[model samples]
Target: MIMVTGASGALGSLIAAKLAASGREVVAGTRRPTGSARRVDFDAPDSLAEAFGGVDVLVAVSAGFAEDDVVIARHRAVVEAAANAGVRQVVYTSLTGAGEHMSIAPAHRATERLLAAAPFAVTVLRNGLYAELLSQAAEQAVATGVLTLPLGGGKVAAAAREDLAEAAARVAVEADAQVDNAHRGRVYELVGSEALGGEDLASALSAEHGKEIAYAPLSLGDFRAALTAAGLPPFQVAHTVSVFANVNAGFMGGTESDLPGLLAGAPRRAIDVL
Candidate 1:
């Protein structure tokens, strides 16, 4: 059986659904039992053990970003449970530039390490930034006619969440015979074909919405204040600001083969998604 953890999440839910629709024996793992999914919580080891029984392939999605330590601990719990259950392989949804000192990098890097050292074969799918953010930015721009963020001249090679979910589904179903053994214990950076800067993003939004959208680059302090004013928690504000900083430092942009290879076609452009 193939198990997709974090089934309630945006990406995980899609992956589980896709795998199920494709006729795979899918077990959706969530914190609550909804429909066909089994209830499994990271803080609850018994739940994990119960949910993981008889599972062959495991799709381990990252925990919620409520806290870094909490996320890492939850990921570790999943790794331990997978190891104990004798899962054959694990496909992890990690972040791009996970070891590059970004805001959420440490937890992802640590989780990758834990998965790598596990008895099972591990595939680390380092997903790029989501284009859904750009979609949201477009909506905000429609209201204000300005796309404002702390990202300076840097760019993000982002793909839609659905694209990543499709990749995860394939990873879950493809067997060792179909996939090369060399891909095991390797990291695949999933990214879009092209990088998008703020101006480029604004242009896309303007074209899509038929509005005079403008890109407003803010100071880091200003960006944090904006997020704070928007009622984001202190930790989230910090995390978001740090992400923008990394974007400025060029950590979020890359042209990689894994994403297009997984899709068997070019990923949907950010503007199209917007």
Candidate 2:
């Protein structure tokens, strides 16, 4: 049995569906398992014993937005439980280049460190940015003909979240003679084959929307101001803008990874990933 955390989410649902389709028993882990019949509550320790009791592997799909201590503590507790459960394989979905000193890297890095100490075999999928993450901005840009952001013409090797989910399921559900050994311990930088800058993004938006959606570069200060005006906390705006700045410094791209190799021969196109 494979226990998949965050089963109610988009990524988790995809992972569960794929594994079940392969005739694998998926013990989905969620805060509340009411929606998914194969689910288990992650926050309830008593529930874990039964869920992890006979599971062969654990696919820990992280819940993003740990902008508070409570969230961090809860996340850490789950990691500890996985270790104590004595599961054979532990697979985690993480951001690409997490903890490499970028804005959100610290949190991801901290988790990586904790998970690394686990006695069980582990696989970390350091997935890159998601294309859908930019859809709202792209749509707004299309409406205004201005692709406005703090990005200063740097590249990002982003892939779709669903694609990453599929890869995660493939790793967690299949083990022993079925597991892909190349993914273990090694952080696969699951990058999209194409790397594009802010300007390139604007161009793509313009082409897709059939309008002159041009890039509007802004400094971190201005970006924060814009985000604040748009109703986000100052610190969150700062962190978000800071990440975009890191992208400008070429922090989001990687040349080679086993992700592409793993997804090869599938019925999906890399473009469809968006």
Candidate 3:
């Protein structure tokens, strides 16, 4: 049996539905159980073992967007529960290697270490930045006729979220069927083929909207001040700033990947999602 944690999330829900469509025996693990979904709250560790019981393979989605300590603690609890429940293998969604300089990378790195040391076999899916995130910026640019960001001249190799979800589903199903799993102890870098910059975004917007759009750069200090004035939490502001800094420093774009090999056909273009 295959179990997908964080099933209520966008990526997790896509993976679970794909597995079910393929006729796999899949279970959805969520905090709020609806229909046949099971409650698998990372905050409540005591209930995890029962939630993971009789699971042959566990697809552990990253529990993210929290403080570093909180993220680490939740991952530790999940690891313990999966081990206690006798799960044979675990597949984890992790940050791309290009994001090593980002503020959120440490927790993901720590989780990778924990999974590596676990008793069960593990597969690490190092997913890239989501193109869907850039769609918001595109929309804002279309409205204002200018694409403004702190990215400077840097480019991001953003993959479609649906492509990443499909890759995860395929890996989990293949792992469950293999006697000697080839995916065990392997890390797949799932980055997009094209690296998109500010000008590229403006061009795409212009073509889609049939109007001239321009790219405008913002200084990090001004961006930080705006975020602070907007009443964002200190950690979120810091994390957001870190992403811009990393991208500007050329740490978030790469050409090599295992994404195409995992899929049945060519991966979807980033523009399709935008």
Q: Which is the leading candidate under TM-score? A: 3
Taking all chains together, each candidate's TM-score versus the true structure is 0.93, 0.85, 0.97
Candidate 2 on 79-119: residue-level lDDT in tens? 77766777777787876763265666766777777778878
Clash pairs, model 2 backbone: 99-105
Expressed as tens digits, the lDDT of each residue in 1-274 for candidate 1 is 8998889889998998899887768888988877878888998876677788898889988886768888888988899988898888899999886227677888898899888788999999998788886666678887999998677998888788989999888777784234556556778888777889999988877887788989998788888888899999887898788878887888777776478777756688866787
Provide the global lDDT of candidate 2 against the true structure.
Answer: 0.70
Query: Which 10-residue window of candidate 2 scores lowest in summed lDDT?
Result: 265-274
The lDDT of each candidate is 0.82, 0.70, 0.91
Worst 10 residues of 1 by lDDT: 175-184
- Cα miss at 142, model 3 (Å)? 1.4
- True-vs-predicted CA distance for residue 140, candidate 1, Å: 1.6
Error of 3 at 91 (Å): 0.4
Best by lDDT: 3
lDDT of 3 at 252: 78
Could you give me the TM-score of model 2 versus the true structure? 0.85
